[model samples]
Target: MEVHTVSETPPDRPPQSGLVRALKVPRNAVIGIGFGIALAVVAYLARVLELLGPFAGTREYPVLGPEGWFLVLAFVLATSTALLVASVLTVVEIVRLARTVDE
Candidate 1:
């Protein structure tokens, strides 16, 4: 009589390290990015409405006007900068997570 043996491996599972275990891809990054965008929008709106920072008024500073042109410029610059920084940070985090996961 001949007998055969079976060899099998267990199923994979997610790590459990408290808060670190709860970390997820894309979703967390998207949330962070969305928060950054919202922050930028609020900042821009507050600046336009003269509700942000100390220097809040309707007076010309250098070249742009206070109501339209100045508000638009401020919004553009603030939003762009915020989005750019958020995006870079998100990318970096994703890369780091990927590296760790690979290891």
Candidate 2:
């Protein structure tokens, strides 16, 4: 006579619901925003340190100088980067979710 042995591995979990997966979009956006901000800060610092080059544009106003322009550019760059990254991640997540559901 032969005896059967039991396995200890846990069963695989069911795929997450679409809504649950979708909820991660906001988290992805936040991650993108953080990355963008970090990138902008680094770029700004490099420009300020003359690593890029000396500021040549004439200052139109005393308060808003080249530094201020850099800040403005950084803001735009960060915002755009955030949007792009968020959208891309969202699409990728959706596709993955769809594949999993189909399977």
Candidate 3:
């Protein structure tokens, strides 16, 4: 013979543990990583095409030669892009968390 208001209602699910919360990643970060991987694949394909072209092995880069230099550059590009995207999304998530906490 009791009635409960919304404020007194029990939660549907139990609270998450600290470790579980910490391990969770925001959706934006996952999307950013996916985009980064796609970009890396494109970069690798481009390198392969360039190396297979008519000028293959004809020219040399400064330190590592054409093949090595291209590989390094592609790696740099992929890493930087992924880091940049993940950082931006992380910042956005932090801001969102702050707003919710303030409420």
Candidate 4:
């Protein structure tokens, strides 16, 4: 029979906290992806209702511009930006935690 004793010393690099660990979710981006989805729906309905039809000539209200294409793009970009920023922050936080542990 062999008896092995593990060392009590702390790890060189500690594991990150649960909050920091949660940021690893790809789809869990902190951005407004859901909000973007809703905006897309609204833009679709606006186009269908021809709400922007009147602006076709005057090119008024960016929302009504180019058949509301701009609005769709804006909403999607906005959501992506938000999510991107959130994900970045999460990554930074995790990195910071890792740095602390390494120290």
Task: State the lDDT of candidate 1 residue by residue for 1-103, as single tens digits.
Answer: 9998766975677656533433443455566566666766676677667685666354656666555665676557656765676567656666887899899
Whose lDDT is greatest here? Answer: 2
User: Which residue runs of candidate 2 sit more than 4 Å off their true CA positions?
Assistant: 1-23, 55-63
Q: By summed lDDT, which 10 consecutive residues of candidate 1 come out lowest?
A: 17-26
Give the per-residue lDDT digits (tens) of candidate 2, residues 40-59. 99888988787878868755
The stretch of ten residues in a row with the least summed lDDT in candidate 2 is: 14-23
For this target, which candidate reaches the highest TM-score against the unseen true structure? 2
TM-score per candidate, in order? 0.39, 0.69, 0.54, 0.40
RMSD of each: 11.4, 11.8, 11.6, 10.2
lDDT of 4 by residue, 24-78 (tens): 5444453446555666667666665767674355545554656466666757766
Which one wins by TM-score: 1 or 4? 4
Clashes of 2: 0
**Which tens-of-lDDT digit does each residue in 1-103 have in candidate 3?**
9996677767677666552344344555677677777897787677767644555356657877776776777778777787788778767667777788899
List the global CA lDDT of all models.
Answer: 0.62, 0.83, 0.70, 0.63
Candidate 1 RMSD to the real structure? 11.4
